[model samples]
Target: MDELKVKKSPLERAKMTLSVLALIIIAACSKVEGQADLQKRQGEETPIQVVSTIGMITDVVREVGGDEVDVNGLMGPGVDPHLYKASQGDVGKLDKADIIFYGGLHLEGKMTEIFKKLERQKRTIAVSKNINPKLLRSGKDAGGSEYDPHIWFNVKHWVSATETIRDTLSEYDPEHAEKYRQNADHYIRQLNELNAEVKERIKEIPESGRVLVTAHDAFGYFGDAYGIKVMGLQGISTASEYGSKDVSKLRDYLVENKIKAVFVESSIPTKSMEAVIAGAAEKGHTVKIGGELYSDSLGEPGSDADTYVKMVRHNVNTIVEALK
Candidate 1:
């Protein structure tokens, strides 16, 4: 009896040790709350919850917020922002978000109304509003609410918005203020380089060929930044269908101005532009489909043009090469 009761076999002890190790591994993998401990085991902590209305805004948020934000873009590649409808899942995501970011001044159409309502209840922001309204190039006069919403087509403008985003985050979480500021500065430098590169690239096009025609009115901001005159088959939003009057007016402009190209949008159907091209041809002027532009959504994830900077660069390069 004093001999410690016949000890377990060596194989049995080994099995017990293996079982305990398996349990530990399983626990580590499931550690949603024990984030730090899980990180020690090769998983990182999801430190923050950020919900953005679109893909481009996610890029900026992640750039500025760094590891502090777990960002989600509700609208992905090829989503039409003007006609976007948020799903139940998206609503849940927005509701749970610590901070919600949206491209504003009605880029999201009626979704902007919902975001405006949410501002009364929780944390949310319109990233585009950070740009000075004075800098905006509106299709209409800017006495009040008619300014363009796509300021991000201009890198300098986007950098300003990034600063606003950082400042907003700093206000919310002062402890990580410096981190957000530093991250914003890093991204801003990239945007600045992109701006210069865009200007130089556009110079490659012949001076007389700078006309830009597109399916949506998104490029007023870009045209203003780069000195191109833009006209859209549709209004400032995809929500507005092209009327016969709109098409007829565009045909007259194309023929009168001798504009040689019209571009299609990545997210929109080409039927409208086809009608424009056909109508313009009837007017004794033919237009080609210039490159497809990333107007509403960015490119699919791993491409050179997926990030906002690269997206803008790709667009500028395509526009320059085509127009040139």
Candidate 2:
């Protein structure tokens, strides 16, 4: 025999039906929230891992990439890129980087092979590669003709490099393209202003007195941009050796021109320029060491010439004060 089922009141049935609908609504909301959370996690992106060969390039990357990238420089203050060789730690950094930037045109001569190898695996860019060939200065090294890699000396040329950095970063990370462009525009404007200011400050020196002499020919672009005559005891690359003849030639130029000052480079030794100074004194010309100029690298952190802009300003002030 089967037991009889009890009949429910109409209000009770309505309440039970409402409870079932509420349970369904609650479950659906939880599912939607879970999906929303998953999407939020997926939408978050990590900063781009960037490795640069020089301090200047690292600074540009930092400026343009902003918080979107993390930049590491292989060379630091007072390090010479022409003579710098990548170490095991640098290799590890490059391997881990999502992108790599280097001053091309054989600036990092010793690291060329390493960069070439890494290019096959990731995006490796030479900031100077896209620059106009006519804008570049050509010179002869021991290996014959080569373009000078010291393009950063010219504010305008470095502006071009900054644009290249912005474009490269934008192309690689399109999501942040607008930010990169904005940052680059701001930086380029500052560079242009810097260029104009440099031109004006250079005029403080008498035309005849506007001469720059250094241990290496790294300031060709600087001299060209600022309308000053430049002479160096050594060739473009610091790797080049200078003999007594080179020193004699440079010393005679200083003496004959009646140039009052010669500058030493931050990345190079002062002994070489000191020798030239002594040689000039022996010739009855009193040439003094103007000051140290930031050549291949920026100054140490918190120094006057630590950043690219400050470095240029410091160099110009030193030159004008000593030569003018």
- Which candidate has the highest TM-score of all? 2
Model 2 regions lying over 4 Å from their true place = 1-43, 141-145
lDDT of 1 by residue, 193-279 (tens): 888988888778777788888887888878777888887878777776678998898888888888888888889999989998999
My TM-score estimates for the predictions, one after another, are 0.82, 0.86
Global local distance difference test of model 2: 0.90
What CA RMSD would you report for each candidate?
Answer: 9.9, 11.8
lDDT of 2 at 198: 96
The lDDT of model 1 is 0.83
The Cα error of candidate 1 at residue 29, in Å, is 25
> Each prediction's Cα lDDT score?
0.83, 0.90
Per residue, candidate 2 scores C-alpha lDDT tens digits across 139-221 of 67523138988999999888888988999899999989999999999988999999999999999999988888888888888
- Model 1: how far is 309 from its true place, Å? 0.8
